[model samples]
Target: MRRKRAAGEPQWFFRRLVAIGVIGFAAWRLMMLESAPDTRVNETIAWGWILLMATVVLGYLGFASAQDIVAIFATRSGTPYAALDDPTDPPERPSEPPRNFAG
Candidate 1:
């Protein structure tokens, strides 16, 4: 019934951000040092970049981002898969009592 924050989202995503940032910075540095012809578009560079991106995706499979997607049915009236354990409570909302309670 409530929106949930995925587990380890911050830490996992930050790690990915740092990894990408480091790689991107290194690429920029290499670009600055290596001069290229303004006219010639290098197929090798394009192919290598595609291969690098695919490798990154494959690596992410091993370092999968965690999300608490399980659902638990305590009464056992639901599907077996639904019995999987996960957090039951929603994150507490910021406290600010309603200014008006008009019924």
Candidate 2:
């Protein structure tokens, strides 16, 4: 019998590389800053602002992820009716049938 590669190897490797790249880049930047001849306080302040922005972005992503989880739970847990599920307006007419007739 032939052996097959693990299905998740590529995805797992990519995730690991991304994680390492992020850490290594951050470390390299920090090290370069430490050796800089001139350090502007504004540059440090910019880094702080960037960190704050990153936090806000991460928070937004967290909220969206939570919303998705809630939607899944609502579907499984009950009738799945809520203000969020309410449509703001009628849906538009379909551009075409959802299924293809020529298939």
Candidate 3:
């Protein structure tokens, strides 16, 4: 028999499903280039950019959606917990100055 998993742990099944869907969509977008119509250089360049931007937008949206779904699953699986670290403590500072300093 399988052991019960704790809440807030990543659900592998859902994560895998989302991963497959994202990869499949990305592959489909790549395959679309093979069927692009014959056209002038300028138009072809524009079409290429359009396809590229579409893929980027699709990827961003897919990632955001998947994250939201995972968050939902995690929250629903169990009660939320308090932070383990002491909140009153100040955040640690880096040992050296940042590279962008112009002073």
Candidate 4:
């Protein structure tokens, strides 16, 4: 038997983890600055952080959706429904032998 490799072994996994960490840190910094009475937060920096985070999230989602759509179409030559009702194919049967049931 062959071993099946994990999907997105390390690249995508690490990228997502790093993105989440950066987003969390940015949010925490923003909140801390807001709560401090004397600290004046830079508006441009905060907005830039938010915009960058949104772009990363949206890009990841779009790429993932495109991969899924392409996989579905690439795997099949015709509609799934048509495959089930094709007349030339033999009906599938179980490989197990019949059991004696008289007890």
* Pairs that collide, model 1: none
Indicate which candidate wins on lDDT: 4
Q: Candidate 4's residue-wise lDDT over 1-103, tens digit each?
A: 9444434322466768877887788788767666556523466666777887788788777876776566558656333222233478687887898888998
**TM-score-superior candidate, 1 or 4:** 4
What is the C-alpha local distance difference test score of candidate 4? 0.65
Question: What is the descending lDDT order?
Answer: 4, 3, 2, 1
- In model 1, the runs with Cα more than 4 Å from the true position are 1-10, 19-41, 65-103
Candidate 2 has what TM-score?
Answer: 0.34
lDDT of 1 by residue, 1-103 (tens): 8435443222456658866875675566547545765433554564565576566766655455222222223333333233246678988989998799689
Better of 2 and 4 by TM-score: 4
Q: Report, for every candidate in turn, its global Cα lDDT versus the true structure.
A: 0.53, 0.57, 0.62, 0.65
lDDT at 71, model 2? 62
Candidate 1, backbone clash total: 0
Looking at model 1, residue 51 earns an lDDT score of 70
Candidate 3 clash pair list:
none
Candidate 2, residues 36-80: lDDT per residue as tens digits?
A: 665577478548655755665576557656665786585674333
lDDT of 3 at 64: 62
TM-score (all chains, Cα) for each model: 0.32, 0.34, 0.34, 0.48
- Candidate 3, residues 1-103, lDDT tens digits: the string is 9765644444567656765676666567656655777568646765665676567668766976776577667666333332234578788987896679688
Q: How displaced is residue 61 in candidate 2, in Å?
A: 1.6
